[model samples]
Target: MTLLLIAATVAVCLMMLMAWLPEFRAEGALLRRWSKGGGENRCSETVQNVVDGFIGNFSAAHNLSETETARIREMKTRPGMMPVTLLLHPQLVTREKGRFGRGRNLTAVFVATGVSALIMPPLAGMTMHTMSLWLLPFLNTSVFFAGLQLLRCAYSDLGLLNMLVTGKPD
Candidate 1:
């Protein structure tokens, strides 16, 4: 039974990993589509430009006042720590849900991995070493997704990652 589980897990992992692998053509196509106006209806360029200007102005002030002055008193202090504090507060608990959900998607890819990991061992009918050949690929894919998820989350924190959080407005 364990061997069967191992084999299934292995195959599933490989499939998921392959699906998630980087494809230059696919990425380039997506970039071109977005540039041509795939999502321009979601937000106007004027709005984005205004937001960018506001963020730039605030960031400059934040850097000059909080970072520069605080640097003289302590080396370990960071000026941008306050944003993270808001993220931790009750008014902002959704951040954790969003983070864990992203993480869970990465981990959920393991369901296939675990199945493959379990199936490979018994299918081969080898009793001495039960480890499936698929385990490495499973782990590798999981790690890859985990890293990608983290990158997504980090971009979101920087306000550089934008997605349609809701359906289009009628």
Candidate 2:
């Protein structure tokens, strides 16, 4: 049972890593550039340019209508919004008509992350007797926070899903 719990935890972590790897890489590059003395204005401009290119490519590939394109552009301007989140917004909005492919796969990944986050704490607690008292709390805490982050991503995806389905913000 303990082995199973550890395996499940590892699997969930791996799934998250695969889903977020692209965003992680982008952030890492941005961080490196900033650390190398890229001024705030320059960094912000670079981010905007990159986001614009992504939005343009995504819009073209998805054949987004003008209104959908405008919506996505507006979404990008929102404070603290991540460009990656917009990647699926158009597809999700269009999905109300029963057409979309890749977004479903991404959504599945996020849903799995959320389910794992809900299950991990109890699973970790069940295996607590096997670890050092100090180590158990540390491991549990790390897993809890990681789960929370994964849940946040899943929650955001759910909001996107809700927006398209119910025609309202979540």
Candidate 3:
């Protein structure tokens, strides 16, 4: 059961990695298409609706972000109903997770790994064999990307909110 849990965690982490690749991303098709300008007319209302939903939810928030920050979001924004858009979108795959957010993820991964490493030593009737157990905690970056992905969604949503309030997508 422990091995299974480890394997599942690893698998999700691997999925997180694949989601980071450019060719595999599925969420930014709209934004990519938008950038091309040829695909906007090609985008279905459902696509627009996903964008609309994203925009609506995004626009409703109160934004205190700066102009430059808002400009970046507006320029690089992806089309998705959620900010998992970072993981699921090709456009965002190249961007590293935000600051502070990355630190938080590293803290989580290492902390979880560290705690497990400590506990597993006694459980396994062993000592000073921390490497394998420690590695197990970081088996995949699911936790890391999940955090970044959620934050990207949130910031994008906030960008959307700011845009709506200001009468521009900025």
Candidate 4:
């Protein structure tokens, strides 16, 4: 039973590293674009304006009210806002959790790893060898990193939105 639990914990951590780490690294690179006066924002704006112009003209031709156009113009000011807004919405967040299920599973794995690491040394006591003393601290660090990894996607999206909305990092 103890060996099985240990194996399961190791599997969970490996899974997260294998599945999410590459994507996280790729997306994390975009965070730098959130800096003030970044060139990426300038590029994003050019695209934003084109989209807004298209939408505004479409709405006007369709006989939509000026109020509708105004609202769309307001929305147009914030590039990449709609997708983030939709993904982060309460309903969509729940649906996302249901769809991916990675975050929750990763959390459980990290927590379990931390707990077992913390507990094993004391439970095994004098029987624990020198290397075992380091396990608890290593697992504690792993827990912290795992949490940051889990939040990377949401943080990246928010950073992108901040660049779009405020034209700078917050």
- In terms of TM-score, the best-performing candidate is 2
Would you list the C-alpha lDDT of every candidate in the order shown? 0.36, 0.52, 0.42, 0.42
User: Candidate 1, after superposition: displacement of residue 129 in Å?
Assistant: 4.1
**Tens-digit per-residue lDDT, 12-106, candidate 1:** 65555553443224432332243345335443565344333433443343342444333221311221221221121112113232221223333
Roughly what TM-score does model 3 have, to 2 decimal places? Answer: 0.31
Q: Lowest summed lDDT over 10 consecutive residues: which window, candidate 3?
A: 92-101
Using all chains and alpha carbons, the TM-scores for the candidates as numbered come to: 0.26, 0.55, 0.31, 0.37
Better of 1 and 2 by lDDT: 2
For residues 8-100, write the lDDT of model 2, one tens digit per residue. Answer: 666666655565554466644553344334233334777666656656766786676776656655654442444344352333223435233
The candidate 1 region of ten consecutive residues with least summed lDDT is 161-170
In model 2, the clashing pairs are none
Clashing pairs in 4: none
lDDT of 4 by residue, 1-170 (tens): 44554554455456545534433442222322232223333446644544454545445434445754454445433444432221321121221311212344445544654554554444344225545445544544464466454455454554443343334455
Instruction: Kindly report which residue stretches of model 4 are placed more than 4 angstroms away from their true locations once superposed.
Output: 25-28, 31-40, 44-128, 132-140, 148-170
* The best candidate in terms of lDDT: 2
RMSD of each: 14.6, 6.2, 10.4, 10.3
Off by over 4 Å in 1: 22-159, 162-170
TM-score of 1: 0.26
Q: Count of backbone clashes for each model?
A: 23, 0, 4, 0
Q: What C-alpha lDDT, on a 0 to 100 scale, does residue 17 get in candidate 4?
A: 56
